[model samples]
Target: MRKLIVTEFISVDGIAEVERLPGVTWNDEMQRFKEDELADSGAMLLGRTTYEIFAGSWPKETGDFADRFNALPKYVASTSLKALDWKPAELLKAHCRKRSGN
Candidate 1:
């Protein structure tokens, strides 16, 4: 079975807010995990908020995360982000494959 590992950027207080440099704690772990987690995935999933942030920053930066992030098939769950320029990123308006399951 595959997995839909939901990752988010949070503060030490469990506040789900975006931080610039301080939130780099899980960078290495996330990069390593995503590198392999996305390999067997048929698609990627991101909420509108997360998608916008991710779309605007990642794949544009230079690093290992960029390589891994840009490589996977991407899907954004959004009603607003109608136009995505990422080579393989797509906006999902309905249900998508659930990590090889329903």
Candidate 2:
């Protein structure tokens, strides 16, 4: 079976928010960490909201990260999403299930 890794962005106080936290610095260590994580992931599994955010922004972005993100196969698990225009996308109809804490 393929390893299903679910990476998430959360606050220290336990809030699920996708935004740059205040006072958090971006450094080489963080970049290397992210690179390592993504290196192991063959594709991206995203929810509707995250998919919408990435699909809208990553296509216009440029750089190694953007290139990698845009090129990876995206598996969007959603019930209401009817269409996906992004390349290499697969819609997992009604396959989205919430995790324990999500």
Candidate 3:
């Protein structure tokens, strides 16, 4: 079975928003970390908002990270989204539940 790994960033106050916090900025170390994590991942599972955000930006980006991210299969969990325009992307299904007969 394929392993599922989840990565999330949350502030100490429990804010899950993606917006940069006050006095914070993106750094080379963070970029390297993300690159390494993406390199280790075979596929990406994203929620609707994240999927939309990524689809809007990553496709326009160019580089190793963008290349790998665009090439990887993207599975989005969204019931409201009617279609996905990104290449190698599809709506996620409840495969785990189906497999376990839950």
Candidate 4:
């Protein structure tokens, strides 16, 4: 079985809203860590907002990281989105329980 690893950035006060956090910046070490993580990941599973954000940005970026991101299969879990424009992307069914046999 494949491992499902979830990574996130949160503040010391347990705030997970990365965009709203102040004084947040990216550095070479962080970039390297992200690059390595992406390289090792087989596919990406994203929510609606994150999928939209990444789809809008990564397509325009050019580099190993962007290339890897664009090339990997993307599975989006969204209830409102009817379709996906990003290549190799699929919109998961709203009822995951059926698929999971839960």
Give the best candidate by TM-score.
4
**Clash count per candidate:** 0, 0, 0, 0
Model 3 Cα RMSD, 1 decimal = 4.5
RMSD of 1: 6.4
- Name the better of 1 and 4 by TM-score: 4
By TM-score, how accurate is candidate 3? 0.79
lDDT tens readout by residue for model 4, 33-88: 99889878999999888898778777999987788889999999887888888879
Candidate 1 vs candidate 3: which has greater lDDT? 3
lDDT of 1 at 100: 50
Model 1 lDDT per residue over 1-102, tens place: 667776566667777756564546666777667677666566677777777777778867887656766777777776556687765877786554445554
| Selected candidate, larger TM-score, 1 vs 3 | 3
Error of 2 at 70 (Å): 0.7
The local distance difference test score of model 2 is: 0.83
* Better lDDT candidate (1, 4): 4
What tens-digit string does per-residue lDDT give for candidate 2 at 1-102?
789987776767878755664456779988897888888889998878999988888899999887887899999989889999887999998676656865
- State in Å the error of residue 6, model 4: 0.6
Worst 10 residues of 3 by lDDT: 93-102
The models' CA-based lDDT, in order, is 0.69, 0.83, 0.82, 0.83
| Model 2 segments more than 4 A misplaced | 19-24, 94-102
